[model samples]
Target chain A: PNADAYGAARERLRNQARPAGSLGILEEVGARLAGIFGTIDVRLDRKIVITCAGDHGICAEGVSRFPQKVTPQMVYNFVGGGASVSVLARHAGAEVRVADLGVDWDFAPDLPIYHKKVRKGTANFAAVPAMTREEAVRSIEAGIEIVDELTAEGPVHLIGTGDMGIGNTSPSTAIIAAYSNIPVPELTGRGTGIDDDGLRKKIAAIEKGLALHRPDPKDPVGVLEKVGGLEIGGLAGLVIGAAAHGIPVVCDGLIATAGALIACELAPSARPYLFAGHNSVEVGHRYMLEHLGLQPLLHLEFRLGEGTGAALAMTLMDAATRILAEIKTFAEVGINDAQ
Target chain B: PNADAYGAARERLRNQARPAGSLGILEEVGARLAGIFGTIDVRLDRKIVITCAGDHGICAEGVSRFPQKVTPQMVYNFVGGGASVSVLARHAGAEVRVADLGVDWDFAPDLPIYHKKVRKGTANFAAVPAMTREEAVRSIEAGIEIVDELTAEGPVHLIGTGDMGIGNTSPSTAIIAAYSNIPVPELTGRGTGIDDDGLRKKIAAIEKGLALHRPDPKDPVGVLEKVGGLEIGGLAGLVIGAAAHGIPVVCDGLIATAGALIACELAPSARPYLFAGHNSVEVGHRYMLEHLGLQPLLHLEFRLGEGTGAALAMTLMDAATRILAEIKTFAEVGINDAQ
Candidate 1:
């Protein structure tokens, strides 16, 4: 990050025709964007939320409220532009790119989605590793490839991470447990609103998976191979790929931030590129964002995932860029500064 | 608010394709809108932020970082659509109506703004009541009249409160001190980034103003006459008027919420009409919103009191309405709900 450029942006904002720092965090966010882009002016005209869809093998453990088949169904919804992410992304003037990461389904050549399936589905982590380390690497590499392909059309100003997979949060909780000292119960939540019995089952399943795999926190790839889903790996790759290209990325809810965890671990420099789209009701999400040292842009008690929060925040980022680049300075407007 | 209609809206949302209560607080907010409108389906087409601009007597207390003249200057900016509120309210698809309530300057008659000035300015609150009770009553009634005139074109679906007055936080802190038991120091913050010395002076000024007037907590009108700005009274009237018409109102920040406190106290029914736009960094705002039992829509650390945050939240409320009103239910989509 360009500290000098960040300071310059903040100085320019301070000279705007308003009370000093009255814009509050929006000013700081704009300044940070300036530093990230290495310029005083930033523009976010081209925005997109890349949602990766995969199936969790943990469904075999009865950890999810929805059936695993719902994964492919939601992908169909995304392709039809009928999902929450699609609606919100459109509202934010952002496009949605659906990635078929590992949804236990095959598609025809005419499908309106990205074809990057790593496997049919992860192995049921309650009994075995979700995928081999090579598969984990491949899943994330798919994400990097997708990002590069998308940016080739033009400069993708901002990207948000999204996911649509049933039973995904079970693995996300397990990933948080491996990386942080937070307990499984403290990290677990009723993903998509499960009843009490399902919650108990999910807690038990995660404890079993953790005990069996004993994944290493330091080895993010190993953790992904052991307990993470393929879409999670892909989402992580999206973050790393965006960082490698010097583009800022936003991640939505617990599912997306779980991928952020892997990406940051794999490439610690990705920290500066990642933005927490919103704080989810999921208990582990707070720990994940805190561990990553990210303050989410929104806190709406959201847990539906699908990059909805990230898409909503993209609009604010665009507004922030406008505030930084469009507003007249005190010198330009001949307005006196605060005495 | 119609509890029956609120329950009906919740039921309708529960039947949506997504899981029950997936939208979280947004679902509740939309349901409240439904109850306020006495319908299961609510539409927020005509939206506006009625910003009351005025001068504060507390300017004589040296409690602010900016000059009192900035009040009218910023109002000019509002008319030019160059202020933050104008930009954000436009972005949120809400109209901005600036009402001059004791602004200490006379706008040209042809200027596109509301002429509701209660007085040239209030008496200096450091040594006397900010306004006579009659002036206070007139200022608030002006707000009510504006709401009626604005909605006369058509029913306004949502109304937001905004204020532009230098050193207005002094009277706001005094209002909280009168009603709440929270100590002034704990509830006081440096509004608009005052230095340590300015913050001290603001606290001392509030303490002195409170001791001098001894404003009765039970008589909200008396409290406004003693310590509130004319624009604050106007904002309070906006809330009461919105409730009288069964419309939901969003309040910007500290100054706006100070008005909300008075409105809710005067007519407890207005509680249902009030939505916190965002929690201000101003310490007194916490007690004000808590006293109103209102949860803010955003927590952007925004302290620029121009209905900017309320404008931003208007977009979210629109999104929430879309989510509740759009999106195919599971049966319509032929998708299975959680098992």
Candidate 2:
């Protein structure tokens, strides 16, 4: 958060063994992390990805084009190792575990479940508060518990939060508006490939939710309890935990950005550990990125959730760290002049 | 290339564990290589990069913004491991070696050198032929010899071509125009970030060369003798050798594209093994890509040519091969969805 640290990081990156400003924004990210950690030899070791799957109560409002069943189906896809995030996790060589934060489905009692299902999904947040404040805190504590368990084994190097909830973007937009103080219409967008008509209905639903909640922006927890989804609350906890434990966190698209906005409100210093993976097609994503003053690594018009963009951006982070760690300095190579 | 074999290769890729068209252009490339090598599983082993360093006589015609000395200076950068290609090759995990194809420098005999200099770089083709037929043959033979030596040691999986020559774009434009039959002015671009005035002069110089050479498009060898740089001729040989030896070759940006165009002419079947790495900012690159019917994997607006694009693209090839070799099929994993 110190502007001086940002300047020093940029200076260190400029001094790396390459042309000035050649690596582009990746150079700045590496430098910023180096300055934050107060070490030139910064490495990402305990990479953690927490995939939170839930069902959106807003699905009852008929907002998403896809059936709400797709949420559970995609979670099965993740568990069955057939989802994009599964393949991406293999590529990133990161540890991934799923959280059943608040999906409607009830699992067998002895099954391997990481987090609690606070309720069988929320009431239609369009007409009422998604969950009670107690339920929201319980979900946040679920995420905090995961981070605590993972970091107890070792220091988490980087944390990535992903979500799998259909019709959740309406809730996300409302949360983004409450935290960022942006207009509701500007923060609304077509989630899961909704048409213009669907987008209009979605925006109107979010406006109703905002009216019902009347969230106070000064209190982060109060704002989340008013408008946020369970996954958003869990992600906020993950972000706070990673920052508290001195691990960097890379936030995925719009939904994750909403979580990060709350995390920043809770602990302002968490913004430094956060890297925006890519700009999502969601209008609210642009608002969140602009509010956070973070630029994404790639812009291939990707809007898929499930942390695919974050996984791909991790490749760039690996590359940057390798360059900083492996490249021989001018002194080591001993090149005289331009010869 | 056998059309049947190519079809079979495509079938194998489509039958892979992932979704159809998920790998994009790489799926086609891997399939085509499978056809070339007559194997279902293709591995990228013994990757080789042939860096052709030369001096363009057009530098004498004031075609380049940088001095002629930068060509040899960059060659030293490549050899000393400071150039972009050097870092890219380190990332690609490939073996890179430089060839002094036609630089205007006398070197010690004991130095590690591939002495295939053709009259200390070509004559200014705007005024005269870039190289005589005999000299062109010599340069091509030198490139083939390098490939033969490398492949003789073991199976050479991927061959990438890079070049270092000041004002080489002048020769590259002439070669591209001769091959693509496009207008010289339309194919010429500002090489090495030339200004508007420099670009106009470069175009004028290429037009003059086209007037002087009047190359026959049908005769690939004759066209090379008339207008191609020594590095282009060498690249043609590299491509030919890779095809004859049944090795996949990855071609870099515009200059390498010119070499690939010549190779495709010399042996039409060789086109199957050629992979365009990335689209460069060079004006002739799009025409060259069109002629080859190859779509590059990445479009990063990269103009810095050192075979760095090819080297970076090699990472994708590596990823594809790893999937082919390591990933378990549905049947192997005991999943009923096996194709």
Candidate 3:
């Protein structure tokens, strides 16, 4: 990111017809866009949201209210343009691209989703590692590969990270615990609306997995291998790849922010290109966002994490960039600002 | 608002493919739209934002950072489609309609603005009533008359209220003070980036206005005549008119919401039709929203009051209504929810 461009963009925004600093986060977004693109004349016409789906082994412990099969079903709904994210992306004038990272079910060869499965699924982390370290690396590479394929076709202005897996939030919580001194109970939440017993089981399952793996915070990849979901890893790669390409990535909800936290840990340069789409209802989401030093753009209490939040916020990004590029300065509008 | 339709919408939303309460504020907005439109199938295709421009006599007290001349200057910016609200409303697929209720300057007859001037401007509220009770009523009636003329052309799906006036915050704070026992100091804020001395002067002006007027809370018309600006009264009528026509009205920041507060007091039924666009940095705005039992849709800390906040959140309303009408139910998608 270019600091000079960021400063220049801020100066430009200060001269817009409105009072300085009145647009709030939109102004910040404009400056950040200028920083990322190294120019204030950046266009974000090609917007895309990639929702990665992969089953979590933690569902065997009854950690989620929905069945694991819902993962593939939702993926079908996504491709069929019937899910929340699909509807929202269309409303935002952005395209929805689905990816199969490590779902247990086999999709047909003609399915529209990206065929990037690393394994059927990972082993249960309560009794064994979620995946070998190599598999974790593969999942991250898959996301980067998707970015490469996308950029080859066209200049992608923005990418929003989304996730789908029934028990995914459990691993998201576990990953947050790996990085912070916060207890598992504090980081745990009702994934897919779990009951009291389901909540207790989720907490215990994370505690047991953490105790067995004892994942080191210094080794982010090792921690992901021990407890993170494949979709989470893929999302982390999406963040890293977006930053590598100088594209802004909006991370949705708890699991997506967990992915962002890992991406920031792996590559500190990715931090500036990331935007937390919203503050999710999940308690652990705030912790993960704080860990990443990111402020969410919206606080609508969204917990449906199929990139719906990102899709909604992409419109604000549109507003921000337009304010930077379109709105005439005070001098151009002939308004005396000395008053 | 139709309670039965609202209940039916909730039931329908629960049956959607995602988990029952996952969409959060969007879901609430969906159900609220159902209530207002008296059906689950509400379409917000024709949207409009009415920005009422007036001048404040309270500028005589050195209560603002911007000069009073800027009110007409911004009115020109709004009509010329260069202001923040104009750009954002275009982005949100809404039309910008400028209404000159009591601006201090005269706009040309061919400027393409609503010719509904009630007066040149309000009197200095710190020393005298802002307007006569009859003029206040006339200003509000002008707003309702705009709605009537708009509906005559075609049905308006949504109407957003905005305001443009110099030192209008002084009168807004005075209005809030008239309704609440909260200290004037706590309710006061630096409108348009005033310094510490300007802030002190603003607080003193509002305090003096309220002490002299002693506006009766029960008589909302007298309250507007005593302490509110003409644009504020006009916005109050916009809210009332929107509710009368069963259209959802998204109220922008401080000045817009003060109008909503007065409208709710005048016509208790208008309360259900109001949606706060975003929480403003202005302290008294939240107090007024709370008084009307309204929750803001966005919390972007936006303080630019030319309906920019309303324009941004209007897209969310579009998404919400689309979610309610478009997403397939679990049964329709053949996804078993009993699992």
Per-prediction TM-score, please? 0.96, 0.77, 0.98
Clashing pairs in 2: none
Model 2, B119-191: lDDT tens per residue? 6888888889888999888888888888898877788889998888878888888888887778877888777
Candidate 2's displacement at residue B110, Å, is 5.6
Interface RMSD of each: 1.7, 5.7, 1.3
Error of 1 at B221 (Å): 0.8
The TM-score-based order of candidates, best leading, equals 3, 1, 2
Q: Which docking band does candidate 3 fall into?
A: medium
Clashing pairs in 3: none
> Of 1 and 3, which scores higher on DockQ?
3
CAPRI tier for the interface of model 2: incorrect
RMSD in angstroms, all models?
Answer: 2.0, 5.3, 1.2
Best by DockQ: 3
Clashing residue pairs found in predicted model 1: none
The weakest ten consecutive residues by lDDT in model 1 chain B span B330-339
Please write out the lDDT profile of model 1 over residues B222-284, one tens digit for every residue.
999998889999999999999888889999899999988988888897887889888888888
2 versus 3: better lDDT goes to: 3
What digit string (tens of lDDT, one per residue) describes model 3 on residues B1-339? 999999999998999999889999889999999999999999999999999999989899999888889999998888889889998999899999999999999789999888889999999999999999999999999989989888999989999999999989889988898898789999998888999999999999899988898999999999999999999989999999999998899999999999999899999988889998999999999999889887898888888898989998999999999899888888877897535
Q: Kindly list the per-residue Cα lDDT of model 2 for residues A77-151, writing each as its tens digit.
A: 666665656666666667666778878787666544465677777778777778888988877777778888888
What lDDT would each prediction earn against the true structure?
Answer: 0.87, 0.74, 0.91
